[model samples]
Structure formats: structure tokens, C-alpha cells
Target: MHEMMKAIATAALLLATAMPALAAPAPVYDERPAKLADATGVRDYERRAVEIPMRDGVKLHTVILIPKGAKGAAMLLTRTPYSADELTGHGSSAHMGIAIDGYDSAPDVVAAGGYIRVIQDVRGKYGSKGGYVMNRPFVGTSLNPTKVDHSTDTWDTIDWLVKNVPESNGRVGILGISYDGFTSLAALVNPHPALKVAVPMNPMVDGWRGDDWFHNGAFREYNLTYIWEQVATHDNASHYELPEADAYTHYMRYGSVGALASAHGLDQIGFWQKIKAHPAYDSFWQEQAMDRILAKAPLKVPTMLVHSLWDQEDIYGVPAVWKAMKPADKDGMLFLTMGPWFHGQEIERADSLGPVHWDSDTGKWWRRNVLAPFLAHYLYDKPMDVATVTAFQSGENRWQKLSGWPEKASSAKLYLHADQSLGFAPSDKEAALDYVSDPANPVSFMPRPNKQVGYEGNPWPTWLTSDQRPVSGRPDVLAFTGPVLDKPVAVGGDPVVHLTASTSGTDSDWVVKLIDVYPDEVPMDQAMGGYELPVTMDIFRGRYRESLSQPKALTPNVPLKYTFALPPVNHVFLPGHRIMVQVQSSWFPLYDRNPQTFVPSIFEAKPADYVKANQKVSVGGTEGSYIDLPLVSAPPAE
Candidate 1:
């Protein structure tokens, strides 16, 4: 009987040995809606508060989260100047409805992933102790010193996260959108040893030039959201009440975009105040812009940058930043992703899944694939298959992978022609058209701030600033349309403006727009829809025409070939749709009023000197001038 029992035991052991032993299967995480409530699998989270020490001596308030039963894991850090109490602590939780509707917070995402999550309030907002001075941003420049700013603050924060957070495999990554996105970018500037990756979406970089805040040069003073933030809240974080920010928040919200200021009883916002304070492109704006600093802030690790094609706030910033990164940093490491959405549309609009065709939720994929694996391999001994760059083209509605941006060998040039038309023709004689740009009622190619007052929030019900149409047909605006296309022609690239013409006045501005005429029969929306559909727009204040950092006044009619680089765009001109360019003098309060008299600087211009000037956009011979478009095609369609 003993021998038989032994034989049976031996057989059972052999069978068990044949079956492979599973190594705990990565500890399943509760990612689904229902599973979020599964405390057995979700709870046991570890949380703590610490004042992250920065190089500048300002202690930033932070909250660290460690997944239960999952140590020795990698870390993901999200730092914000908003409110570390909320972002890093308990306030950003679902109970506050800031992080999610019926879901958890970013900390929850990291906690569930069995990783370490660190949230820090940037130097001067919320529980963190410091002055909230976000109006200023950093670009790599010798003229500007390394202050206790977003970039430096970021470096210090990462230094602390990698060192203090226990079980943090030393490797760290950063993530945030909008203002927080700016903070994420800051960390990448001279990254620390453990900071492995960064993702900055709709980031607040160059606020003076292209941000929604200060278009051309005018102040979007009535931007309602920030107006409420400034008027009701004002340098105080206690009033960051989200639901109250909703228009339904107290009827203070106006009817349309234009009525918010009067409704809120505020004539101006601080953002506008800052613009008004600095009339010249001086240090006030230069130090705040990122273009000057991106190059010096080399990429130490793999970085993913994202922006919304329609991100009213930073529409032009994403591509600009991508192009600004030096070629050496282009180690197939700088990845870019553009979507059809706007700033914060992902969480704000309830879209965890990626855009229409991408299928995977961008943030999730970014985290799991790029960010997570980076941390794992460098910190926790894991491996991954990742990509360097990926961009989403809206018109095409598809994602395309590229080793580098400005992709290989794609070029085509469309020139400005006669009449209110657009095409590939050379200089012609169809006669120049004109328009009257009344200071009180200026024509616009793109919408400006409305009474609600901040970034593209034009107060009036006007067609998102499309009145720029008459610019080509009016007496004040000069017309240089392109010829009709024989085949389907599309434009996809940086829009360049070259105006080899002069002005009748001493000081003025040169505004050029690349328009896509959607067949005169596209039908208007009855409201402000009949204006112009500007595919691309750029403007150069005559005084600053030669140098963005310098000033030069026109000698009156002394042809000045001015160049203004419009933000890059990727648009397709189907058959029937025409490509047109409009040249004019003013974009007004949008780009601060140019003192038409060529004063020493935009600042020295006397209000009395604001005279009307005659600007010419002539073709042929000596006055030969035009706009150049970087046309692109390929990557096959998906």
C-alpha cells in the first residue's frame, strides 16, 4: 500500500511540474468603470505629503501615491502651478469632480498601475508657497537668467521625486496639459538624472507672439473664464470652483462670447494688463516666450509633444516648439501628436479614447507604451517596443509615423496672383483690389477676443473674425489671388510671407493671410459666417519687420520686403476651393495699434501719431513680392 501511494504522489508531482508556473500575472489592475469600485484590487493605496525642495529654496507642496503591494515599480510625475493641494493631494479627486465624473484621479491611474505617482504644486500657486507669476515663461536665452521659474522649478521637482519617492525605480516621467503642460516642459529643460520622459499638451510657451492670449499684439481682455478667475478669484486658489466656472455659475456668464466682460463687470483682465504694460517685444515678452529657450533645453530622454490643431489657445505653439527643438535632439526621440480637439478636450470633453480613427486613447497609450516602458526599462528592468514620432493630420483624420518632422522631400510653392483668386501662377495684371480698415470696425482674417475676453473669444457674434474677406475686395486691403487649380491641390506646411512693397506712411503693419476660398457657393451660416476662411495668417508690424527683436520704421514708399512666418498648417484644397492671399495694414487691438508714424518703438508711438497709411502689394519688375507655401503629400493615407 505504501509503494502504491508513493507511485501516485510521484505521478501527481510530475504532472504539476509539466504545467508551467505563472509569475503572478502582473497583478491585474481595475481599469474598467465597474472595477474601479473593486477595493480588493484597487485600495490599499499609500499616500503622503512632502514639501519638494527646489534649487531655488522654494518648497513646493506635493502628494505622493504608491500602489498597494506594488513597490520597486517605476514612477510618473505630474507637476502643476495650479494647486498641488488639489493636483497632488486629495482635492483633485473625483469627489471634487475635477479629476473625473464617476472615476478616479491621475494618482488613481498610477496607483492602479502598481507604480509611484508624484503630484507637486509648482512654486507659486495653491498650497505651495510662492508668488503666482505665470504670465512670464522661459525660452533658452542668455539675456534671461535662470530664475525660480517653471523650467528650473521643474528641474528641482524631478530631482526630489527621483530621490525621495521610495520604490521609485529612479526613472521618472512627466505629464500635464495646458498650464500644467508648461510645467511638464519645464522639467525637460536640463533634465535630471532620473527624469526619463515628458508630455506637454496645449502648453503655455510663447505667450506674447502666437498664444490665444495675445494675438498679433492686441489683448484678449474679455476672456470670460480667466476674467472670472481674475475678478472673482484673483490670485486666490480658494475660488477655483469648477462648477462655478460653468456659465450657469450665476448668470454672470453673458449670452454670447462678446458679452461676458460687462456681465462680469470687469473692464480688463491681468493678461491684457500685462500686454498693455509691455508695448514692445522687450524682455517682458522675450523672457516669457519658449522659442528662445527650447534649443538650450536639450532633450535628455525620449519626449512626446502634443497639441490640438484647433486648440484655440496654443494652435500655433505645438508645431513651432516641435520645429524649434534642435536637430541633435531629433534622435528619433521627439514624438509629436496633433488632434482635431482643443485644449484639455480629452478630459474636459470626456474622450479617453484617441481621435476618430486612432482607436487607442492617446494619453493611455502614451502612458502604457512610451512613458511606462521607459520607466520600466530604465528603472524596473522591463522592455518595450516604442516609436519616436507620430502625428495626426486632421483633414486626413489619420495617424502617421515619421522619423522626423517636415518629413522627407515634400515641397511645392503656390504664389499670389490677380483678382480674389489663388493658385500656382506667377505675377499677373488683374488689377489690385482694396478695402477700408476703419479703426473702429477693422476687418479680421481670424477671430479675436470677445467681451468674455481671453484668447479668440471675440465678443461679437461675428463669423469668428472672417470679415477679412472684404480685405481682398475692399479699398483698404490689397488683393493677390492665385490662379484656379486644374487638379486637386493641397497645401501642408509653413506659410511664408514676402512683401517687397512699401507704405505711404512712416509706421504701419503688414498683415498677410493665406485663404482657402471654399467655392463661392459653400453657403454662409447666416451669422458671422460670410467673412474669409483663413487657411493661414501672419502679420509684421512695419517697425519690427526686419527683426522680431529689433525695430525699424519705413521711409515712406521705400519698398520694404517684409517677411512674417505664419504658423505651419496642413490643409487640403479640393477641386473648386481656391487659395488666396490678402495684404493689408492693420490687424488692430489684436496686434497692438501700430503708431503709423514709425516712432522709435511700439512703445514710443504716440496715440496722436496713429495715422492712416496707404500700403501697396504690387507685382512685376522691382516690386516683385509673393507668399511661399510648403506643400506636402504622402505617408500614403493611413
Candidate 2:
């Protein structure tokens, strides 16, 4: 059996390596159909790579694309940690220069008719001077420009672009997705007069609460590639190339996250050290919380917050930042646009996410009607028709223009009943469903055939909406499913998982998955019969439930309520479909496993610390566990 397992693992690894390695999503560029400058006029555009001097004397590598008639045109800027060379090649259009996964053209630049597009490598990243600090805290109330940070770097970069660039109208607009989005937020903290508009899509606002690094105090193990390779390394963004081709096998061989660095001799990397040092939410992470930093000073510039329903990385931070940067008027400066797409998918191909289709090319629609007009209105003083908040309703396959996001959703509880069933009313009799969680055999985040190159790779972009049928019947995963729905139930905003459970061990990890179970029957070619689609999910390190900064061990077999959010969702459980809540203790490879035995830090745990945790989820009259969904009535009959 042991030899067979080894052979199987080796076979998987060889299969993965035999095929070409899938690349991560590329930097987003405008993918609009028409050209601002025609083929004849395209020859007139000039591209130049220059190092712009910042306040601290650190020069940032910048690429400027100026159209022939762009003398008085607005300046559209995107400051990114990604290489500027990749975003804009010598004199090529933004779309043509970079090979991106999804088609996202620079809508703001395209709609401005003819404009100066600037792409700059942020400090210490790819051809730029100065050390790169991840989500560098905003330097507050400091008059000295020498005491610089990301915000000041942005301020200095913009100051130089407007003054030095020729025939400048002096109006500047900044926008980006992911890390670039974070830089865009940094620009708002200390905005120059020329900075007129900012749009940050899926920006990293809080690393601790919900973002790439951590989710509710649980370390996101799968994203270690992002930290160790991409941001923490030298000027050039690096990637973790697996010798084994199977990341799961490679990670399992490492045993622990600390082992990955220590064995590899990578302690010198500043960000890697920082990640290991702060296992819990501490002052280090608190300082990097840009959302809290921005809360102190409201945004003065017109801003738009864009997010996808399936944004795997930074969904939590977007709405949080929007609320903090509150615009008093509903239809004013602060606005939100959400679509049923994955992270960066809104900018890419928005025809579908995984097997689920939104019934429209959402990316094209948003750029043409939503983002383009908003940018044009601000930059070119063009007439615009924009929504205060626009959200794409999933099951119904339509868009909703609301007064504001998640339109005053009402709460409804779905209780876990005795017979592994789900319902509204709590059961009068007490019952408990038990499962044994062995750290040795953790639940897979995605279905089998989950090798790196085959199913999904590192930075699993679309895994947020991946099918969940594989683990639905796993022995270690306790699933409480509802009956076939007679009517469609629309869930908007955040959903809270109220779990009353106990573990035989001192420490545990809790993962909650909200699923939309398709009917058992479907078309022959569809092959989606009884597919379990995860709408939203989240994990909680049990020790930090009381206080993220301070972790406490649980008394053995003591039943307690574990309430945590499954982030937010905007989906409908269509009639004939079923709603399911899967409770499990581990989602391996994606997250580091809990030792079950209490330890100061799981990162520092010995191999002996690993143990089986028999978990019991209670469902009854007094101790009934349920998920409170932000349910809303269907759109009023057309």
C-alpha cells in the first residue's frame, strides 16, 4: 500500500511536470474594442522608460505612453509592484504590450480619447529604487518628505508626472487591481492637487482580518508562494518553482511553514521573517491596516470601489474601506460596483466563473457603461450615468442598480436539524453530529486531481467558486443539507456561521462552507448533476475566537458557540436546488493544519503535537447552531 501510494504520488507529479506550467494572472490593461489612436495615428504615440525622482531621492522606474495629441489630455496612472516593462512595452498599446489572463483594457485611459498613460514600478520592485514594504503604513502628519512611505512615493511620483510631462492638463487619475489597488489607496492618503479620481479594485485594506495573508487569525498556507516568492524576495518578483511539480507533496514534505524557510535558508528575507514572527494579530499587522489608517481622514477625491462576488483575496477589505471612506451623498464620490466574477476576472473575461455563467460579458459591460463613463466624467468632464452601487445578482443572472450596496438586507437563520437536515425552526430535541479530524488526513480545499498544474495552480485564482462535490460526503466533514428549495432565496451581504461545537482536543480549526447544491438531474452533456458549488467560505483558528491578538486553548469536550463570518455573498439558491452548510476542521494545503494539542504557535509545533480531534457540532433547542444569512426579497415583478 505504501509503495502504491508513492507510485501514485510520483505519477501525479510526472503528469503535472509533463504539461506546461500555468502562469499566474497578468497585470490588467484596458481591453476595450476601439483604439483611441488609429493604426495610422498609433505611429504618433511615444513610449519612454524613465526613472522619476521621489521626495526621498529614490528614483522609481516609470513607463510613459503619450499619444501624439495627448499634450493637453488627462494623465491616467497605475502604480504597481509588478514590472512596468510588463505592463507597457516600447510604444505598444497597453492591451498589446502585456499578455494578461483576462482582457482588461485601461478603460479610464481609452475613454479619455487621447491621454498620457503612466505605469511605474513601486519602490524596491522591478527596476525601481528603495526597499519595497508590503502595505507600507501611511506616514502621518510628517512634514519631512524624506521620511517617506507608499503614500508619499505616490504623491512625489504624481507631482513629477504632471509638472514634467509635456502639454499637461494637470488632471490625474489612478486605478489598479490587487497590489496596484493597494498603491492606489496609498495615493489617496496624501493626494496631490492633480490627483482628481481614484478607483481601487479589490485592494488589500487589512492583512489580518481578511486578505491574502490571514483570514480571522488563521494563516493562509496556500498563499505562502505569494509572500515568500513574490513580495518578500529581491527587486524581481520571484515564484516558488516546485522540483516535485506537486505543491501539495512539496508542502507536505516541508511539514510546517517555518520549515519551508529554515530548511531553504531564507531567514534573511524581511517579509518572511515578519510573517513568521507575527503568528497572531499583533502591532506589526495593525500598523499595516490601511483601512484603519484611512478612517482617520476621509477621502476628499472622487473614488470608486470595484469588487467581484468571488474575489478570493481582498473581498473583505473593499466594503470595509468603502464604509470608512464614507461619502455623505449616496450617488456622490464614493461608489461600489460588484459583479459575479472572480478576483481580477471582472477586468478579464467575465463570461463565466468556473461552470457558472452570469449570462453576459460582464467585463465588457462594466468597462463600456460603468467604469469608462465614471472616469470620463471625472477626467474629461463628460456626461455620465452611474449607479451609487451596482451588484450582479447571480442565480437570476441580472444586474441591480441600488441606492447603496447590499440594499438593507434582512437577516434569516437556517438551523441545523437532527437528521443532517437544515431548516428555519430549531429542533426541540438536542442532537450532535460528530466527525474525527486527523491532521494526518486533512480535507482538500478543492476536489481530487488537485495537483498544481492540472486542477489549479498556486494563487488559485478561481477556486473561490470551484465545485465542492468531492468533500461533501467525506467522513471528516459534517454536512448539514437543506431540502430542495421550492422558491429562490437571495442572499446578500455577509453570512454568519453560528456553530455550537466541541472538540476532544485542546485546540481546533473550524471551516464553514456555504454551498448551493444543484439538482440531481441535468442534461446528459452538462455533466453537472448534483454539483456542490461553494458560494462563500471562511476558516477560524479556534484559539483566537475570543481575541485575535490573544489565543486561548479550549477545555476538552466543552461545547461552546463558535460564531464567525463566511465573508459576504450575493447569490440566489434557485428552486429545485438545495442549500448546504459543511462544517469541517481542516482544509489542507490551502491552510496549515491545527496540532489539536495546544501549542504557543502551530508554526513552532513538533510533529508529536499532531493528533486526532473528534469534533461534535450540537443542534438542538437551546444550543442550536445556525447560519444567519442576509436574505432579501426578490426584485419586484417586472
Candidate 3:
């Protein structure tokens, strides 16, 4: 009887060994609804919080997740100035984890061979101990590592993580969006040996030139509400009370930025005070600029940059870095992906931006195909067909992977005519359009009754695609419209505006907006027709025409030409849609009004210095004002 039982057991073992092991089921792709819920398989892991000590002995608050028994898993790290408290502890909502939303958009990184996920509070933030420096500059070749910046802190954190974390594969990658994205960039300046890949999505590169803080040397005072919120929330992990309900009314009442610090007790806000002190692109701003510093200390890690055409803030960061890194990218590791979404929409929602819809959930496709695979390649030696540039061209509503950006592009000139006409051919007769721009009655960047005050509370998810009807007929704005298009004119690269104009005052501003005029015979519910959607726009301070550091007064009524570029556009004017261009001097409560009369600096300009100015857009016989578009072929027939 014993011999027979042994024989049966041996036979059963042989049969089990002969059968092949089934492959793990493919990761489920969740349809990202408006309200996200807990993921199906992501919670089968162990999560805990730890205090990781940096080189300087400052302990940074960190939350980490590891699969129940995950072994040889690569580490994915994201450090943010924002709170990472939601990532760990009891009864935490899986969907509420910002890092999970950013990386595991599929909501199942665990099912895809789980990684060791980590989120850390940067130095001087939330649970971290030490002083925080915004956009902390990289410290090069430090003899005593105790005296460190963001880069060294990241390196020290990574060292501790790889050593302490159980079953880690000793490989690391970093990624984040917005300020977190800026931290990812800070990591690349001096990367650890384990750091392999990085994706700095819409990084905050330059505040002084064209990001959130300034545009062409103009201080973005209204946008400062975001800074105030950051200061309040980062340390205490709580929301700050706005002094007033209406930001526009409150800020306008304050009169000047300096008043915020002096009268409003905003001097406690260190960054705001620093911003007021440095009005120009001075040494202070240069020291914090990521692009300038990266150029000096060229990055060696493989990086995948992602951005959007309508990223209201930080739109200038990626472009500046793209231009600066092209020469130093000897390893061909620099890659770029641009879409028609707004801000961080490339990660959060790429299916449609505001009212603009795409053929697929571009955001999902990007995560499942582009973003996920790219990170996996460097981390796990997975194969990837990496493109130099992967841009989603709107109007065509298709994704195009190209060898390079602005690839073999041709320029088409759209001339601004006297009769408010926009056409390819310049007007033979010289003409000009004039408008009175008053600082007291400045044009509202957004429609009135804008109750959305601060960046944290504003209903600005789709402000980039808002209709221009609000500002269309304003006396301070000049609209130049083109005839209905018989065929779609697709623009591929950066659009440049060459204006021949004169201002009545020594100091003024030039604001250019590119709009897409919808046909008036579409769905009423969707408001599809006659919708004047702004595609791209930029502001230029007239005084900074010569140099960003030096201010020059405009020669009054001299018709001096000002040539500047707008944020790049990746869209087409569909057939039957008319292209429109609007020129104005002020996009108020958006940009602080530029005093028409030059002062030593606008920050110190009194209410009396605010003066009205007459601005003109001129057409010379041959050298007329025009917009040069990077024209490309229309989409292939359906």
C-alpha cells in the first residue's frame, strides 16, 4: 500500500512539472473617467512612510510602495514640493495619489511587474527638514557633500533607497509634472549612478522670460496667487485664505506689487519680495534658470521631455531647453513629445483639451504606448522604438512621429492689411490701424465676472481654449480676420510675428493672439460655430526689444519694427474656418499693465505713472506687418 501511494505521488509531480506556466494577464487599461476610483490590482502591495536622510543630515519625508513580494524591481522616484501624504498610511484613497495618477495612469503598475514606487517631500517642504530653495541650482563636484542642493539631496536619497529597500534591482528613474517636473530636472544636473531615465514634463525652466512669473520682462502679478498658495500649503499642509473673493478686484485695488509686501504683509513671502526687487532678467533670475545652468552643466542621463502647445505656464521652459540641449545631446538621448493639451494635460487628459476633441484618448495612448514603454526600456532593458519628436497635430487629429522638430518646414507669410483683412499677399497701399490703450480701462484677458480667483481655485482647466468673443470688439483690441479658407492651412512649428508699429508713449506693450474662427453653422449645444478659439498668444514689453537687461524707450510715432515669436502651435485651420489675429497692448489681470511713460522700473511706478497710449499696426508698401507661419502639408484624405 505504501509503494502504491509513493508511485501515485511521483506521477502527480511529473504531470505538474510537464505542464507549462501560464503568462500573467496583460495590464488592464482603465477608461479614465472624470472621477477616478481605486484601481483593481494596484492595492496588492505594502506601503509605508520613512524619513530618508540627505547628505546634509536633513530627513526628507518619503512614502514608498512595494509589491507584496516584489523582487529585482526597478525604483521609480518623484520628489515634489507638494504634499505626498496621500501615498501611504491607513485608508488612503488609491485614486487620490498624485504620483499614481501621473505614472500609473493605467492604474495597474503592480500588475505590469510591480516597481518600488517612492514619493518624497523636497527639502524645506512638508515633512522635510531644511531650507527650501526654489529651482535649487546644482552644486558641482562638492568636496564636502554636507553642503548640498537639490541634486546632491536627490543623489543621497537614491543611495539610501537602493541600499535600504528590499529586493530592489538597483535601477532608478525620475519623473514629475509642473513643480515636481522642475525637481526631476534638478535631479538630472548631477545624477546618481543608478539614475537611468528622466521625464521632466513641462518643467518650470525660466521665470523671468516667458513662464509663470514674467512674459517678455512683464511681471505676472495675477499669477502670483499661485506662489502665495504654495507658501501657505507647502509647510503647513493647509489652504490659505484669500484676502478677498475677487482676485482681479483685490489685485487692482492693491495698485502695485510692492504694496502686496508692504501693506498686505506679503513680505513674509520670500519669493515675491525677491521678484519685486529684481525687475529685469538679472543675476538673481539667471542663477535659478534651469536652461542656462543645464547648458553650463550638460546632462548625461537619457531624458524624455513632454509639453503642450497651450500650457499657459511653463510653455517657454521646454522650448528653451530643447534649443539649448540640441547641441550637447551627443548620445541622442534627448527626446521630445508635444500635444495640443493645456498645462499638464499631456498626462492628466489628452483625449480633448477643453472643447477640442481628438480621435483617441491621447493621454491614455501616451501612457500605455509612449511614456510607459520609454521608462520601462531604461529600467528593465525593454525594447523601444523611440522617436526624436512625437507631436500630436490637431485639426488633423492624428499623432505624428518625426525624425526631428520643425522638420524641413517652409514659411508662409500672412500679411495684416489696413481694412482689417488677413491674406497671403501684402497690401499694395500703405495703411494703419490705431487703438487707444488705457491702463485704467485695460482689456480683460478673460471674460468679466471671473469669480475664479487663485490658480488653486480657478476654473482655468480650459482657459487656453476659451472663445475670444469677449475681447473681440473691445476698443483697445485690434482684430485682423482672414477670409474663410477653401483649403486647410496647417501650421507645424513656431509662429513669428513681425510688426511695424509705433506707440504714442516711450513705454508700452505688444500682445499678439492667434485665433481660430469656427463656422457659424454648427451644433448649438456644443457652440461649435463662430467660436473664436485662441490657439497661441504672447506679450512683448517694448522696452526689452534691444536687451532683456536694458530698457529702451520707443521712438514715438517713428514706426519702428518689433519682431518677436509666440509659443509654437501644432494645429490646423480646418476647411471653412477663418484664421484671425488680434493685437492689443494689455491682457490685464493676466499681465501687469506696463506704464506708457517709462519709469526706472514698473514695480515702483505709482498710480500717477499709469497713462493711456495710442498704439498702431502699420503696413509699409513692401515691408508690411505680417505673421510668418511654419507651413506644412495638410492631412491626408480620410
Candidate 3 local distance difference test against the native = 0.79
Model 2, 13-67: lDDT tens per residue?
A: 9988866655546667868765575454435556678999987788999988776
Q: Which regions of candidate 3 are displaced past 4 Å?
A: 1-43, 87-99, 102-113, 140-146, 232-240, 454-457, 523-526
TM-score of each: 0.72, 0.88, 0.88
The sequence of per-residue lDDT tens digits that candidate 3 reaches over residues 1-638 is: 99999999999998787665444466778877869755546655766689998766789999887766789998888888766664344354443233455432234442464677788988888888887656665564321233688788889989999899877899998888878788888888778999998889888999988887998888887666666667644575554446676656765776766665456555777777777878888777777788887887677888988888888778899888887887788889999998777777765656777766786888777777788888889999999886889988887888889877777679999999888889998889798789999988878777765554544546566777888988999888889999999998889888999988889999889999889998986654366678898889989998988788878888887787788899988888988899999999987777888879888878778989888899888974676899999998887767
lDDT (C-alpha) at residue 469 in model 1: 57
**Clashes, model 3:** 0
Error of 2 at 325 (Å): 2.6
User: Candidate 1 residues 1-638, lDDT tens each?
Assistant: 99999999999998788766543356668766853532333335566778877776778888776666656677777776555544533433322222222111343245435667667766556667765554445534543355666767777777777667667667777777777677777777677777776767778777657775655553333243453463343235333233332222222232222333334444445543454456556787776566556766666777767766546566667777787884767466677765545465543332322212233455454444554454455455667665555555533435555566656535554555545444455555633333434443454433332222322453332222244554455567766555454455555567677667666777766777776555555443343223345656766666666665566667886766777677666566555555667777765433445546765534334446656666666554335566676766633423
**Cα error, candidate 3, residue 22 (Å):** 71
Best by lDDT: 3
User: Candidate 2 versus the native: TM-score?
Assistant: 0.88
Q: Which residue pairs collide in model 3, if any?
A: none
